[model samples]
Target: MAKYNKVVLAYSGGLDTSIIIPWLKENYGCEVICVAGNVGQDAELDGLEERALKTGASKLYIEDIQDEFVNDFVFPTLKAGAKYENYLLGTSFARPPIAKRIVEIAKKEGADAICHGCTGKGNDQVRFELTIKALAPEMPIIAPWRTWELKSRDEEIDYAIAHDVPIKITRETNYSKDMNLWHLSHEGLDLEDPANEPQYAKEGFLEMGVAPEQAPDKPTYITLSFEKGIPVALDGEKMDGVTMIKTLNKLGGENGIGLLDIVENRLVGMKSRGVYETPGGTILYHAHEVLETICLDKMTQHYKQKLALEFADLVYNGQWYTPLREAMSAFVDKTQETVTGEVKLKLYKGNIINAGVTSPYTLYDEEVATFGEDEVYNQADSAGFINLFGLPIKVKALLDQKREQK
Candidate 1:
């Protein structure tokens, strides 16, 4: 008597997911349908269909969501300047869209349950399950790490060998990873110790780019154009979403632009260390930030800064499908109406130096801002304006003086 007759599993051609297909069938007597979302993990998708079927899956649906990921998830978060604990929300924001598609495929196949490979100790389990709960409440969710007797990835590897399930990763090179168009994150292995500096070279784990020290000596300049707070062109060339990310990824990676090693607090109240590489995303966030300073007014920009922190916290904790995130996005989109502009930057080693920035919506007026002789700004106007602005302080000082005399 099977509990679930049909189950949809979020499948990557990786160790955990590869084993889960057979496990689901054996334990629950269910037909398994696997869904893989392609968010720009280039080489990770090879022979996925064959692999899924070989492992007992009835079918595999590989969805290409790179454009939607960038436009809907990446850009909006960028527009808000959202960075979780100073780390870009690469893996965090990525979970929602992928899970949304998983839910869609499950509905199409009339699946009785949804399953994922996220561990109980990690943040991704909460992310994946919360998305399922929001979009398809009736569908039951399965987490193997919560139920399976296997203790660690090493035990899982032994199980895989026993079951004749093929995997490229050996225990020696085993590092948990999540990759998408915006960023790639690495965890586990030697990274378990917070004191350990990542052995990126020995592990051969850097997929995005080189270390900053190994970068080329010379600097490279690039001109980026934005329309309505979205990047439209690079160095005077128009590009589509995926192509733009690919182009900037090459430039930023070669220049050693984006890499971070941090011990972060997870959604499930655990502390974990990981290495995150977000080459192009680092550039886009910085460039958009400078452009907004020129384009947006003082109050809007400062207020958005506060909201950006809140936005980052929400996305990092996997509340993407909630109304709060939707409301935050509304404010971000409205602020981006005049964020059209161009910015030129010099990329040298790990530094992104701002060369130039311009926008038709720029509020900067040379006549009003000049240090030299200017016709518009009257220097004498400061006296009356400062007095009026400081009237509260002046009154307080007088009252304090009278109290002191008494």
Candidate 2:
């Protein structure tokens, strides 16, 4: 008897997923429906419909969710200043919107189960499954990597070959990657060994941009305008969220602005190294941070910085649908109410230099901060303020002195 009547698989048309369609049909005797979410992976979608059908899939749904991804997922994380150990949480937050769309497709198709190609040892499996559980609590979830006969990518390649499944990579060229409008991440292969420096000059090693050494000699300066923490314009020209990010990606990529190499602690209790290229995101984060310096008060800024770490962890661990994340985002949105400003930056060979920043709601009073001649801030008044601020320290020192005399 068939285990499932129908199954909706989150398909990427990659090696693992290409083989999964046939695997599901052969093993479970189920009709496999593939869902590929388009979150800005450009060339990756080419001929995807044909590829899905050729691999024994009954149908394919390529959901265009780029606008939702950037505005709903990326911007909230950006406003929260959530960066997981220097990773902009690019792939971290991207999973929810994709998985949510998959769940919707599953419901629409009346599928018996939802399946994904995520491996058991990685964070992505947790991400996909968590979103599924949150959205469709009763829906059966299938993880092929956990129960399949294939143990490694090499074995998967063999399975693909035996099934005549077309694959885009070979043993020597396979580097696990995830790409969207926000960023591109490269892992596996040479990156598994932290000691090995990435072969950036090698063909296909870098797809988003060139290495920093190969960047243009002259610096590139660009201006960004923000309205309530959301970027609205580039170089004084109004733009939609998608267009602004796309424009920045080109400008930042040309200057080699955003390339990160880190061995970060994954949520699955292990450390893994990966290289990321987040050109537009890098510029946006920097510009927003600079704007906040003049807009947000010291206490709020310090407290938000502490909260940002927690926010980053939640996103990294795939807790996007939880109430805590929603609460934090609400708080972050409140903080951004006055974060309207413009910032100019100089991009020079992977370095982002702050040129200028301005905000109408800026709390900086030049008259109170000037060193030349400042009547607004009474110099003598600081003596009393400092005394009061250091009262606890002074009292502690006095008590220690009295004890020493005894």
Candidate 3:
């Protein structure tokens, strides 16, 4: 019931946001400023400004954040090797930065409140509000789905049609989606039924990429070079983060790679099925793993795997602002000190094969590891090492022999 003279909304020009602008204006009598963040959704952003204006938004702001999306958000999570229950945290990683930009725009525009089209039954509501609360504690968050009378996507469509909001969606193809440079996620519709097998070939609903079976027969080889855990080049061609993502996406998608379908547990106590397309991210995850194998010691690699699971959970649950996440980031960064290397991958029909990997600081010493004679490693030394390593086993065997005699 808080009064607001103006509100800035995180608008995507989708059906939900299209209706939200007029609803906010009519219900709260506040001027609405729509802000759209472009984090490599490609042509989905075309004509967004005019669309927002037609939907009754007084002002519209669209910002290009592709590089920042990859560098500040995606790479950090990638370096940490975070994945949410075997699925990469693609959509989860992009939310915090988008919400941060929403707060920044709200403050600049002198708005008392910020809004989003996220529903009450989703994780995005928590992600958006948490970012707002962390960045600007006093700024009020107006979540229409939680408070409004509008119930379903069908009702929202009706409202948009009645208001002449220029919506491109219809009831037949109603699947909630979120897209970024890393991945595209599809939810709702037939996917909600767990028994239903997802149709990846469907043109209008699923993201336009390749299916594994439909991918090219010939494998495409790619090499990713990294510096201090950040990807710096592709196949000896130096490129920025945005360009690197674009290049890899093309390579990975061509091979029909990076499609994930799962029933995920939402933070709001609901189980939802989502199909994700993360072509570039799939390549990066595999390439990074290949590099880590050469650079990280056995214990560091094992312990970092444990941290990655926790990090993924925190991000998925919208705990991006917590101290534990920062501490974990520090630990992840430390392990990446020698993660500088090139990982060669062979992409073929949805499989990313680790072709070759090399690092300047690699712990893999070929000379000492050779089965043949090597000056650095003496064969006789293995006898002493085996005795020390098997001390506990030897003691247990002796105790068992003594017990049998008793």
In terms of TM-score, which candidate is strongest?
Answer: 2
Q: lDDT per prediction?
A: 0.91, 0.93, 0.88
Spell out the clash pairs found in candidate 1. none
Specify the highest-lDDT model's number.
Answer: 2
**Candidate 3 lDDT tens digits, 1-406:** 7789999999888888989998998889999999998998888799999999887889898988877888888898999999987789877878888888988999999998999999899898988888888999999899999999889999999888888889877798788888788888988888889899888665554454688887888898888999978899999999999888887888887788899889988878878889998898888888898899889999999999999999999999888888999999999999999999898889999999878999999999999899988899778989999999999999999999999999
Global CA lDDT computed for model 2: 0.93
Candidates' TM-scores?
A: 0.96, 0.98, 0.95
Q: Tens digit of lDDT per residue, candidate 2, span 1-406?
A: 3399999999999888999999999999999999999988999999999989998999999999999999999999999999999999989998999999999999998999999999988999989999999999999998899998999999999999999888888999889999889999999988999999988767678787778888899999999999999999999999988888889999998888899999999998999999999999999999999999999999999999999999999999999999999999999999999999899999999899999999999988888788889677788998999999999999999999999999
Per-residue C-alpha lDDT of model 1 across residues 1-406, encoded as one tens digit per residue: 3499999999998999999988898899999999999998888999999989988899999999998888888888998999988899999888989999999999999999999999889888888988999999988899998998898999999989988888889998898998888889999988999988886555367889888888899999999999999999999999987888889999999998998899888878888898998989999998999899899999999999999999999999889888999999999999999999999999998899999999999999988898999889888999999999999999999999999999
The 10-residue segment of model 2 with minimum total lDDT is 200-209
Steric overlap count per candidate: 0, 0, 0
**Model 3: lDDT to the true structure:** 0.88
lDDT for 98 in candidate 1 is: 95
Per the 3 Å backbone cut-off, how many clashing residue pairs does candidate 2 have? Answer: 0
Question: Best to worst by lDDT, what's the order?
Answer: 2, 1, 3
Candidates in descending TM-score order: 2, 1, 3
TM-score of 3: 0.95
Q: What is the lDDT of residue 285 in candidate 1?
A: 91
